[model samples]
Target: MGGSKTSLAFLVLLLIGLLSGTSSDAHSLSYNFTINPRPRPGQPWCEVQGEVDQKVFVSCDCDRAEIKYLSPLGEEVKSMNAWETQTGTLRDIGDLLKEHVSDVTPERHMVTDPLTLQARMTCRCEDDRHISGSWQFGLNGQMSLHFDSENGHWRVDHPGGRWMKEKWENDRAVTEFLKKVSMGDCPAWLQDFMVCWEKMLKTSDAHSLCYNFTIDPQPRPGEPWCVVQGQVDENVFLSYDCGGAKIQSTSPLGEEVKATHTWEIQTETLRDIGDFLKGQLSDVILEKHTARGPLTLQARMTCQCGENGHINGSWQFGLNGQMCLLFDSENGRWSVGHSGWSHMKEKWENDRAVTDFLQRVSMGDCRAWCKNFMVRWEEMLKSTASPTSGPPAVQPTATAIGFTIGIAVGVAAGFGIIILGWIIYKMR
Candidate 1:
């Protein structure tokens, strides 16, 4: 009887440990809106999609101007103090944007065929206590202009953005409004949203990790450094400098991983990959560039381990910010993005050894690494502080607002597999 009671006490303590160890994950509040004066048969004139941490919570379209809650969490959002005001404001912004689009230019606002404007605004608060905000505007699905709200600067991306920048940059009202909204109002709204989403935003048991390596062909004199950044979910945990041969921990989770044997193996693996990639860059630059001032090569490997023990892995290669190749680890197939690089695809596909190695690393090795790190991740969370119990007394929400825009599709480059016999041949 006494032994059973002791066992029960142990179980109780374990449950308490689990609950106390709970830490909040990164959260984001964002909205995507599109303005199309002339809509297709099924399309809406003005459309809006709102998300909290990647989950679509609410959406509105021409069929219904009223916002519709798509998730249970979104339903709770109606109880927020400023919910009605905020929703109404969003509608007002949509109408204002439509008017603004009409006044731009004949090329943009032609009576017969008007160019659609895509806009997005986002406020993100990370577990590390970092906050980020963005507002982007695009035309005909191409990103044209971006606003840096903190500095109130408008950066022109495409030629179409030049006129918009010229019009808005000198306009103090426009700059201040963007600055006030993103730096002030967006964070305020996020704070309110966080209160209702505390339980929903808790760190999940499932684990995800990604490593992105960007290598420049002709890095400027002071910037010859090739680095690998590793992210566990949305937080950057570790970064390795290839030139300096140094590894720096960016978070508590990273510090813990640094002491393990796994870290040692990972460092060596990264170095080998970097060296292998460096050898191929010159040939690629020669082939792709007739006259190139600046160019970069990037490789990304990602893996996710679900609560159900299912694992998914992917490998992506890019040049100058354009996706060139994608590896479907599940099917062990290489997808070439451009026809110009079909030579690379044929070479890699024919080289059975190299193809198999990439599949093994992405599908097998990456999954193993993620599973091991997940244990460490859970342990680290136990020492972290819990999220604030409640949001502070609401600040006066600002009329300033901006959007977070997704990248526009571009010409995808092609990828060539690395020949790393000396480095990876031993893995077999």
Candidate 2:
């Protein structure tokens, strides 16, 4: 079911603030369901929202039996093999709450007059590596009852909840079901979602592309003489074997782009750049490591176009994959990340031709390429069943009954475990 505090709405706001400041390592998943026993003009009898890592991802307009995905991640979830089962679970939970509406509301407020019920279930992996889960139920935005996995007991938050608490606490089956769901099912689902999320990050481009070029002054017979790897949103799309003068596509997008005129131009240009880098590295090795031996050089180019139409670009130079110099493509300024590279930075900063070339390539060619590739990729995906986007959905408030601690921090941090008994869905 769901959980909340004195004022469920207010508690939701407070928890949002706390969650925002939480350490990056912490992750959470939650679902909130709202039910209207007596519907008015256009209000639905039940509605559900599913959130992952604090962002609303999926929602169902139960009145119409329609589901809307709020983000690309949501689309990925919808495409999962278990998606139908997941949605079915949502529908069942909503229906169950509607059927048992009176059991969760106070006797005085159980009249036929219009009344609203809100419940939330959540599970989280905290900064300290502790896993917690909770369930909260509220009527008309006021929290009534909650259950914490740690305590394995139901507590009445409002006097109105006394009747429901007494009824649920005595039922051993209900208690065990809540406990198993919050502690077992929820955490398992969260971990599985995180794995899918990590995979998504590597395969999809949210907004950016990066290319890394590595050149070796002395390569073994079995090694690549020089190579360039292209990545879109951290996903390697293509690789160029500089020594063999071959370009290998690593992804569908990359394979499609290979047929474009720009691909040939890009391959030739990268080969030229690789030669230029090898020359520069030879000079640097002579100056910095005459007695130390051969050194590899690396160049990384990155460009991104944001929602506001701003194109940000940067170029980085390093030795053996250790970053040393950074070039701001917008201003044509060169800087060194490490003091040892200060000499190289000073030499390059004084060359007007080098600065102009770097600036021109980043702002002109790089920006154009990034925008072109992204548009093509988007159009290509849109034509298929790839991740789709939808309008933003409102966030849901979370409430929970915590073990050991009574109110304030404990209750605010607690989240419920969601389980729809009829639907035995396994997260893939």
Candidate 3:
């Protein structure tokens, strides 16, 4: 039982030791420093202060403060202000110094100056009383210090340091320098590099307008026609000529006007061909068909108008091999001459009458000829048999001449055979 009691006591002691060790480690690892709520900025008596290892220190005065540390040989170490020093346990102080100073050594020295005596003594502690090769104090009663690993030198984290401001000013200077270097218009080669930039910047409508103006064609037939299709502003114009005739029109607006002058083929000029046409036809008609071909016929005609104002159209005739009527129009008058085919020349002789009629009717000479030809041709077809007919031609018989020739040939063959036999007999 005693042995068991001893084991229990040992276990309890072990647990207590572990708990105490854990608490100590926790305490050493973390620290915080806060301004006394009683002191405010801008107050006459307001001051900043801090402590390290329970050692009180003044960081800054109401007006200003300076902290200074000296080595045993009285060499100045590091100095900063109250707010710049971090207050924490030894482990936290080590970590803080490691963050600012690379390869921080375990040793350090520091000092701070606060103008007010109250602030200087306000920061006091027991843990930081001892000093070995180094010691630390807050600047303006704040901030922290530790040894730099690289040189075993002390460093202070001064929160109010001017490093950040200096860096920002340097950056601004660099940017301004770059701006100066890049000043001025781009090089000419670079300017030329963007040849299509203007086109790219134009609106779609403008692009389309330019393309339309430069690239389309318009044409008119009959005349020595040339067409130009292009845009002017936003409007398109097409121009052309038709056989010396000219018409100008606009699309979308549909505005058009045309004027042309063509020659008049006079009745006298047509009369010469009228008889020739009648010779080719069998009969003719006037408005209506009759057993006799009409002396004059109403004809529908088409005239080809030349630029020189000459009119031309074909004329037709009747089966009797005569010109029964003359269809001709000149200027504006359409005329169906009442003269028979044989009188075509006489009909043409009255130039004044023919001219008057053509002018009054607005029918050209060729138009009149075409009209008259159609009337005559229709009448002739009606009075005559079908156009396909002529006479019922007699078919010649296959004569006995062929039989006679055959018989002659057979007799000649018999004679040739008989002569050959006679010759053979003579040879034998």
Candidate 4:
């Protein structure tokens, strides 16, 4: 009995180790991965049609995710209270950060010094305590350290030491310093360096936001679409919604382009852009859709054209202000002259950063296109706002009777073959 108990305790310890190891797999608050939660067992996605139009909402809010901005070392943290939030993920970090910053009560406004806005950073540290360090700017730009020294180890009690260093500038210095000081071995020079680094962060007004969330994307297989939350600019949030947003097709293409979701973002209409495109290229047809919303979600269709409107390219459209297509267009022969939009027009002639998305459709593999057009359509409108002007298409699905007829035809063909063989043998 004692031996069994010992074995049980050992097994418990082993399980505890496993669980502790997996703790690193946690998301910033959310993560990105493919999911196919709709299909029935053993059934390929080909069996389902409506799955292509389905939308799956991704939760970017993580309970553990954090958004860190210019808590410049020496300078007071703009959102000091936010440094303690440990829940929420990428899904809602933008909103969370916004809320955190907005919630901080503002003091009397004063004409402040010129602070750099180089970057708005978001990071998920192994220990949230590591994200910040101790130091503050005293009156007249005086700097003071708020760390405690004990047993030859230096530790910051107020969570304000590490933030003083630039995230990447001379990262080697911090790395070398941290290699020694990371484990509570902070020295005087390291503390001063931290203060200078934090100053750089507080002064910069513009820069790329960095994310270092510990993440494990729990991707569901066969999940058609995925959503990702990120920012291209400091305050501008970007969303790539791939939930069942499908690419449309015209006659000759037969849905050659995979139906995919357009990246949803705050941007303009595509028809106005299409007009711009039409001004540049002759004979342009822009198919557009306006989803119901206050913003009037818009989509403008641009088909890939070969000789005589033979479509060789296709793309998925999103309610957001972006479009991407892989087309073998004769129109590409002309130099795209839009001073601001030439890069997009010239994109995908040969795939670089955006060709890895392969979506399976009834037609074939649809490569994901990432060219964004910032042009607005003539206007955002609703279907109910306008009367129906075109005849609806009528498609009749073939029934099981068609299969019966095929079977009957095959039986007749077999009988005829047998009879012909017998006749040939008898004649010989």
Candidate 5:
């Protein structure tokens, strides 16, 4: 009985050791550290580099994992275990091993994470005196971690760090500039210009901004003068002189035009005239006219199509050298006559000259009229009696000959009918 009790006590102690070991294994402690930068699209990976406390303790709830060392570059160094043994340190001094080491073959291990949503990292390194294995944090959705030994220290490296930093700086600068401009806090000199500039930007009309400034020339008293005008591009500091109806660009990209004018102002408001001309030619000027001559008047005239399907018009010169003209397209005709005093003979001569000119202008359509005239001539020849020819008047003779032929045919039909009647009566 004593031997049996001792055996029972030994079995109870062994059962207690197994239960305690399973409970410890089920409730193992884990440490997780994260370092998140601001979220940005197209960024490859988020990095986490920090250290953990030395003492290994068991806990159910924790707010944050403790960081033990802060490197010179402000990163944290941490260590963890990969295997379930829990008997050896995973990482030690001067061990450069990346997280998420993957083994493709039985012998070769590559540090890569194919999944984009989650990442599992494990690293190990050994020297003659020290051996280390690192258990890193898991990431989701495709990520990769790199490790390197720099100056006898281990550090995590991000590949796209420099590009991301530059992009961030550029975005910040543009945003700040826009904010300041929108708030109307720009410089005094630029405030007025900004109103137009912002309108151009919103509309995206480069042409309007191409010519924003203007110059108006004033005339001295008692002198007829010309106005000089200029325009400037707001974006580029380019100026164009439009004084001569000519454009001179201040920059290579500036646009220029040569302008011409028919009217000149001697007593009108220079500002008003300048504004008017500017409206007409957006970037042109009106230069002074050194020579003078009689004003030439020209008018645009149109004629409707007539029954002949043609349009016609003519210009008539007057005695005063002015012109008065009337065009009649409805009847395919035109009349041009002068009224100024010269002489009766001269007036008639001038009228004939004008008529001849009209005829020359309408010569293309004259072919139709010529064809009608020839047709009328042919009809007249067939209807009229010959004056000096052998053919004489024979209308009465021709009528008598037709009447005689009709009487002869009637007598022949009557005789043939009588003969047929007599033969029928005899046969009956």
Candidate 6:
């Protein structure tokens, strides 16, 4: 009777252990398993587990089965008789160990909770800062963990970002940003200028934190422009330069004729902000002087931004004040606003010199027209563009009329595709 009672008690305890999932056959154990690049600063928290095509790391609690991973990398998995690969469709780098462990078949052991949801654990072993594992491409689509040596650190690496997606789980639009000290992964002088330029838009420390890109001149140093760029493994550019119309030729008679454009428009964004400005070139001509002692130009422009965005009612105020020309992206067309002088109107109607100037200006430089434009408009800073010669004789020189004529050139260039500077002028 005593022997039978003892046997019955042992069986009941075994059943309890199995149901609780803590069953241990003398030497088996579980550990905390996590996957990696670890999330970015502001990204959503992602528990490292069940990642596809990622490097695997192994560890275990000190008291648990003395955790041992094949060192020197890719050796083999040593088998433990107590544990067998659980039959299932899921597999990861950990399962790849079955190849080395004796008697273990390709059957994979996927870490799951009682509810079957992937549950993470604390797998830490004394002496094992981290251990890497191996995996074959044949084992894709299912969970995979690999223990490998990269740069000397045992890390959980992934071919794609968390959970197998190519992008960040956190959908923040701020990836590329600018720095005034001109020190960072991106530089206005090299890569995307809009990113750096917009970085200034979000920051209020231009006097101390901005680069004055000097491909051309922009008022007192955009007092210092610089581009220090780096490539992000995933994101693309968000614009950072300008384009202008190039005079292809002069007519035999000296009239402004046959010109080629030297401008290119490019934008990169995965999310669409309703009123984003793609680009803008403004021509502010001071008409009848207002008695307010304040100067106001009959500011007209061919703003290239988004739909549902109003200009001036004035210049489009970058989306929510961000530094960019927002416009409707249908044809990526330019919006024309001519409010005065017929000559300027004529230019607004048809010219490429101005077109090139405006395009570049919106990207972040006003030097496409006259280097003097930005220098004269200190209210604005930061610049870039190649040096350009003044327009033909028909183009007015340094006076208000000349300025109007210059804008007229940009306008007339427009009727062509119609195309696209900010210049302040006082009527003579």
Candidate 6 residue lDDT tens string, 139-168: 111111222111111122222112312121
Q: Pick out the ten consecutive residues of candidate 5 with the lowest summed lDDT.
A: 123-132
TM-score (C-alpha, index-matched) for candidate 1:
0.47
Q: C-alpha displacement of 146 in model 3, angstroms?
A: 99
What TM-score does candidate 4 get on C-alpha atoms? 0.17
Q: Between 5 and 6, whose TM-score is larger?
A: 6
Q: lDDT per residue, candidate 4, 191-212, as tens digits? A: 2232333333231111122101
Predicted structure 2: lDDT = 0.61
Which residue segments of model 2 deviate by more than 4 Å?
1-206, 379-428
Tell me the tens digit of each residue's lDDT in model 3 across 293-411: 11221121233333243443322222111112323333332222222334433444355664454333324443443333333233332222122232112111211232344456556
Runs with alpha carbons beyond 4 Å of true place in candidate 6: 1-222, 225-332, 335-428
lDDT of 6: 0.21
Model 2, 123-205: lDDT tens digits are 76443334666777765444458786656667775565777677777878666656655565566556556656755433222
For each candidate, the alpha-carbon lDDT, in order, equals: 0.61, 0.61, 0.26, 0.23, 0.24, 0.21
TM per candidate comes to 0.47, 0.43, 0.14, 0.17, 0.14, 0.15
User: What does candidate 3 score on TM?
Assistant: 0.14
| Candidate 3 segments exceeding 4 Å error | 1-300, 307-340, 344-348, 359-428
By lDDT, the candidates rank as: 1, 2, 3, 5, 4, 6
Task: Name the top TM-score candidate.
Answer: 1
